[model samples]
Target: MLDTQMPTPKPRVIAGESHDWELVIGLEVHAQVATKAKLFSGASTTFGAEPNSNVAFVDAGMPGMLPVINEECVAQAVRTGLGLKAEIHLTSAFDRKNYFYPDLPQGYQISQLYHPIVGEGEVLVELGPNDQGTPTARTVRIERIHLEQDAGKSIHDMDPALSFVDLNRTGVALMEIVSRPDIRGPEEAAAYVTKLRQIMRYLGTCDGNMQNGNLRADVNVSVCRPGQYEKYQETQDFGHLGTRCEIKNMNSLRFIQAAIEVEARRQIAILESGGSVTQETRLYDVEKGETRSMRSKEEAHDYRYFPDPDLLPLDIEQAWVDDLAAHLPELPDAKKARFIGDFGLSDYDASVLTADTTSATFFEAVVAASGNGKASANWVINDLFGRLKKDDREIAESPVSPAQLGGILKLIEAGDISGKIAKDLFEIVYTEGGDPAEIVAARGMKQVTDTGAIERAVDEIIAANPDQVEKARVNPKLAGWFVGQTMKAMGGKANPAEVNRLVGQKLGQ
Candidate 1:
């Protein structure tokens, strides 16, 4: 059992009220499990396939079909629990959550309710920079992580008169990780979800792709008197908690924050008017920036959860758990520490590099191959990352491979290429992949390392501009002008350090 002591609640600001309020928040993050096949069947889990094409017989709930457990999925869930430092139940059972929807072919979802696989995990979320640029980390306790099958998507935009169901996503495995009502604000909620996504991504259990609906959050929001939470903290009373409204299907971070803010204020208004806040499921209109009621929030009893008849209780041995734990990859925190210690990176740089596993791997590969830690980090974080953002490309989809990038850095380290020339070569590599050395040589973009050659160029520049030379001899500040002119004359292929040296030598400054 993790520590459950809550700190003194801070005051919250109501929209148009004089008295301060406290906004309490909790989140249910539904992360799509990264697996090759659906949870109960052998259907392909690939996204963007034709509708109904990826559905298996069990996924489609065909008559006479029986559900079979995927051992890999179970192992993946256990791996996630271990990563979260949570309690892994040796024997967990699945329950059937009955519901009706056009997207749900079976009219029930196979989920875990009675015995969740993982329990009582804690996530430390780093709230964005404060005014002093220092980040504050807040720990949100995770209640449990339970596995369930995903429903198909109901698309309503294909025709105004008809809605269509795409079963491509049906029966996909999802891990609903529920958090305690520990979040204090919208920013904290977003941070919690982001941190959870990062952990899942690091664990290799979830893709954490919000755009693909692979990762989404349901935000539970409520408000009470400023000091009421402190009372709950001391007493551990759930009744002191105000009624909560659940905002469903919030995928975008901006919209998540907006929905929470709007919903919290709405609750505050209702309570201030002496009307109790209704517990309901609400949908956020991204365009309108408001949340509207969808339906009354259903309780656990409403779902009538019971162990699935077709599936047996999931049981695993301690040895298998221990083996899986031993083979687990270095997680985000460890990787961040290693980056700081091994590569001499600051905490901020380490955080950025380790935010995603792919980017961190790419950075390490470039550093290892090129033997330029700081330089490689700079290029990867600044130049390559900027280009990737501009092109809307992921680090894994970067056109410039780690080897090619390392080769480019090596050329710069060996003084065979200038910084400007290296940048141009990078662009070339990014657009058209090739050997950096060959590209530099083919384009005659090598830096001018010969002192004699550079000296001659500096001399010519000085002879043409006697006035600037005289100014440099007097003030010594005008020497930068000659350096610029020399580099420009060399088609930006001049080594900047050599150019400055040669320019100062010619001007006698």
Candidate 2:
């Protein structure tokens, strides 16, 4: 129920200095539905499988084979639509898009064109920087979400003179979510994708794995005069919006931004040079950071879209939509607010922990087990997260489990180990998991909390460095060195405050 009739603002364009052109962008994101089977066949949706090993007869378009829709895929699409707050179509039908490709054994892809499954929705994309320097949010309108089958991949590296077709990906279920050209800048566009990915991950509908091609976007780029968008708003003329070119297969955020910028500049140059920007499909080269023409953009008629004859229209009851909505997981924004309010964490901390579902779950577990919110937050953000980044690992793949991490925090809180000693104990727990108490005992990493033991260590250090003591008695600043050495001699386990008190008493002026 978004307001598509709202006046679309015009972007700023400098005159003469820049030919006064505004870049208008829209995105069509193809997210592979997180289901075990293909859209029409029972073939495995696993990646990295041997070529053609995962395809079924229907996927290969064998004669007499009929398409059967996967119920799980339909449920997943509904789940995602609910997460996006989109309107679910009670009755939706599929269509056949006729096209010719070497890898498409069916010669036409089964997709939802005229009647999509999900209707208008809105996504709030963070635009500016967050409190922690992360980006802020911007609201973008969703045009529609349609279910479609993916085409097979064409591999050209198998032979020197010939190419090969891999149908493993053929007929994989995909949700082609289209967005309006409401995004104004490249940063907002990237943030929009990031937010969409986060939502899909939370909904458990899409894995959002860009590297493996589970999620990809097709960018629509157009240029207009600074005030032309306003005029289009008043007239509702699509032509006044200027011709648009589609950039295909943009998998990464960096490449998405770069491709949009380059394509816009290329179009601006053409327009400024008295040439028209051709409406076509183009490919983005990550290495070269440029887009090259693929082919002239095709219209719906070019594909000859027709109602799929083999499959019936999908019909779902309102009760089911209500059930899915009832079970929706705590989304990112809600979880972030809860983390901030319940744990007393800063907004930045909340944002970081809630960015990913696994990280947020892990943090909550550690805090609950340790019963120390602040200390647990510190360990999660500093110790565990630092190691995860250094080793290029994710929170789910951490070597240290939540219980073990909680044990470390508990030991530090109880004064059973000093901060420095606890770091070593953390390493032991991370590299070799076990009872933290046992690790501390095995390594003799107990803190010198007893006043007598700490005083003895401090006195011995002062006696060993008499000249340093004399300097400290006179300057009072040199006592810090003695304190450091005393702690170091005791393997960083001596109580630091007690050491300081003893050192100051020995160096009485």
Candidate 3:
């Protein structure tokens, strides 16, 4: 899916006092693996639990308790690597990254440095609209994916006089996905993270709930003068890329964009002022809307990485990887393409429906039950999605089930109820659950499809509007008004196609 030759837009240039500079961006997204237990312990990986309640001996890093690898966690990492079309290392080893922090129960955190689970991969990121509003797609390269253990959370807000450490998240499984500096703009950076989250969610390896800290990203941003990037490309020299400052633990997509803009502007101002940009780690302040230095950036040597002595190197079999690939479900891109080909959906509509696995499953179930792909897609995307947003609900929390929605669409297809009646039925089912057919029958909501009744209604409307009739006879486009008037008179229970037909026949169009 990598399309490096797809003509990219002009670099995102920042105008300086004398020269124009372009932005270079890379992201390190850390996604928590979805598992029932912690990576190295049997502790429950439940969120919102009492502090320290889920801790196990291994999770607490107690003396004489050695780390044990969770087989499911390792499998999840491999599955994620395959989903990204990355190369899986059959033999990989874990290293201890030494760092002293209050939240890290183990003085040395287990991570992969020289050997990682996954190798180079690429992702296609869809970005801004063209002149006609069609999105432009660009490809971003992934450097590697490594498995690591997460540090616990430090709480400083409970009481001003004290700081608390919550070890519930300690030793949890994390997949650090590192990206090459292929992103050229802030929007593209956000899009890359969004796409990675979507893919991981589809694979079921990660829930990708940014609000709950299940997924987070560290963005590396640099600014360089125009035409330097091409030189770097030719010589394969990273020096052509300006000094990059790492922005740590960004969760919100909006905040990611804002932080990138602020950081890039900060670097540009420094370069223009005859000051060399420093290589350091920084934090983005949401309220102040600026970037502040946190600490000096550390290289791999600073972490002092070494193979963990207690654990043996992991060696996976190709047959096992193939089995996992065989079991892999249809991914987002394939599903979107199939929806467009089979269901006659627009690209945008298919993209929206297939962005999340739950939404796509619900949509397909509705289509299967109703046997009307076009109508089913319209209802799910327009009516159901709109109502869910208004109620602040996710599709999983929808009051109306797919079977009920299919029932409503079925009634509309069978000519038992009009579209307007279907809308009323949807509202009823949403507020109070019941069968669509039963509700329609009990409330006498079916359309009057009898030809005699439809003819009579059409005649009355035409007789009442002779001027409109004349206008319609002369101008065929004006006949729509009569059709509208007749449907309005019938309380929206009249079959719309039948009404349009009778109106046209009576008006001699």
Candidate 4:
């Protein structure tokens, strides 16, 4: 999927005082592994627990409390690597990244630097419409995926001066997916993260919940001249790309894009003003809509990474990885393609339906129950989804089940009810549950398909609107007014096709 030769869109250039500059962006996403326990402790990994309640002795870094690797966390990391279509290393080791913070009781994070469980990978990011309204795609290269333990939260706003530490999140397993500097624009950066989140959510390796801090990204941005990126690609020189600044711990996608824009502009302004862009870590101030310096960027030597003494290097058989791969569920890309191919769905419809697994499952169930593909897709995407959004409900929390919605679609397909009648039936089924057929039959909501009834209704409409009928006869398109009035006069119970036919016939068209 790594399309190195894929023609990229025009570079996103920021106009400097003298020359234009292009943006080079890379993202390091930290996704919390979906597991029940900490990576190297017996502590609970549950969110919203009481402060310091989920900590075990190992997580607390107590004397003589040795760390124990959680096998499930390792499995989840390997599964994520496979899902990303990356190379999996048979042997990987953990290292102690030395750091000091109040939230980090261990004073050092156990991470992988020398040997990561997952190697390089590629993510195919689907960008939004270009200037020509044509959707473009980019394949971003992933540099590596390393497993690490998360630090606890440092709460600073609780008291007047004193700060508090919440250790509930400490020792939680995380997979740091580092990408190459392949992203060009702010939108592309967001799309890349979105694709990564979607892939991880599909894999079930990570929940991809940004609100709960289940996923966070550290974005590194650098600005260069127009053609410097091509030179860097050819020579593999770091100097070609400008000095990079790291934006730390961005959770929201919107904020990530905004931060990149402001940060890139800040660097461009500094460079244009005859100043050098410093390499440092920065924080995006949401209130100010700008990035502020957090600290100087640290290099590998600053972490003092060394192999963990307590834990041994992990070695797994290739057979185990293969087994995991075999048991993997259908991913988002494959599911989207299948939905398009099997259901004859548009790309947009397939993308919308397959954005999440629950929606896709519900749509498939609707298709199965209704025995109609296009109609089911229309109802699911247009009617059902619109109603769900209006009610501020998720598909999983829908009042109408797939079978019930499918039953409504079946009523329309069988010509038992008109489209207008189906909408009313949908409301009845949504608010007050019942069989759509039974409700339609009990309420006399079936379409009047009888040609005699439709002709009489059309004749009545023509007799009432003498002036409108003259115009409709002269302009066939204006006959739609007669069709609408006739259907309305019949309480929207008339079959639309029969109404149109009778309207055209009576109008001498």
- Using TM-score as the measure, the top candidate is 4
Better of 2 and 4 by TM-score: 4
Measured on C-alpha atoms, candidate 4 has an lDDT of: 0.91
TM-score of every model? 0.90, 0.90, 0.95, 0.97
Candidate 1 Cα lDDT to native? 0.87
Residue-pair clashes per candidate: 1, 8, 0, 0
lDDT per model, in order?
0.87, 0.86, 0.91, 0.91
Residue 93, model 3: lDDT of 92
lDDT of 3 at 143: 94
Model 2 alpha-carbon drift over 4 Å, by segment: 1-16, 130-135, 225-241, 459-478, 501-509
Cα lDDT tens digits, model 4, 1-509, are 22234345666989888989999999999999999999998889999988999999889889899988999999999999998889999999999999999999989999999999999988888766668876678889989999999999999999979999998999999999999999998999998989999888888999999999999999999999999999999999989999999999999999999999999999999999899999999999999999999999999999998999998999999999999999999998898878888889887898899898899999999999999888888889998999999989999999999999889988888999988899899999999999999999899999999999889888888998899988877778999998889888888999999998888878888
Off by more than 4 A, model 3 = 1-10, 465-481
lDDT of 1 at 26: 89
Residue 183, candidate 2: C-alpha displacement in angstroms: 2.0
How far residue 223's Cα lies from its native spot in candidate 1, in Å, is: 1.7
User: Candidate 4 — which residues are off by over 4 angstroms?
Assistant: 1-7
lDDT tens digits, residue span 251-273, model 2: 99988988988888888888888
On the 0 to 100 scale, the lDDT of residue 402 in model 4 is 91
Q: What local lDDT score does residue 307 receive in model 4, on the 0 to 100 scale?
A: 97
lDDT for model 3 comes to 0.91
- Candidate 3 residue-wise lDDT, 258-358, digit = tens: 99999999999999999999999999999999999999999999999999998899999999999999999898888887898899988778888998999
Instruction: Evaluate model 3: give its TM-score.
Output: 0.95
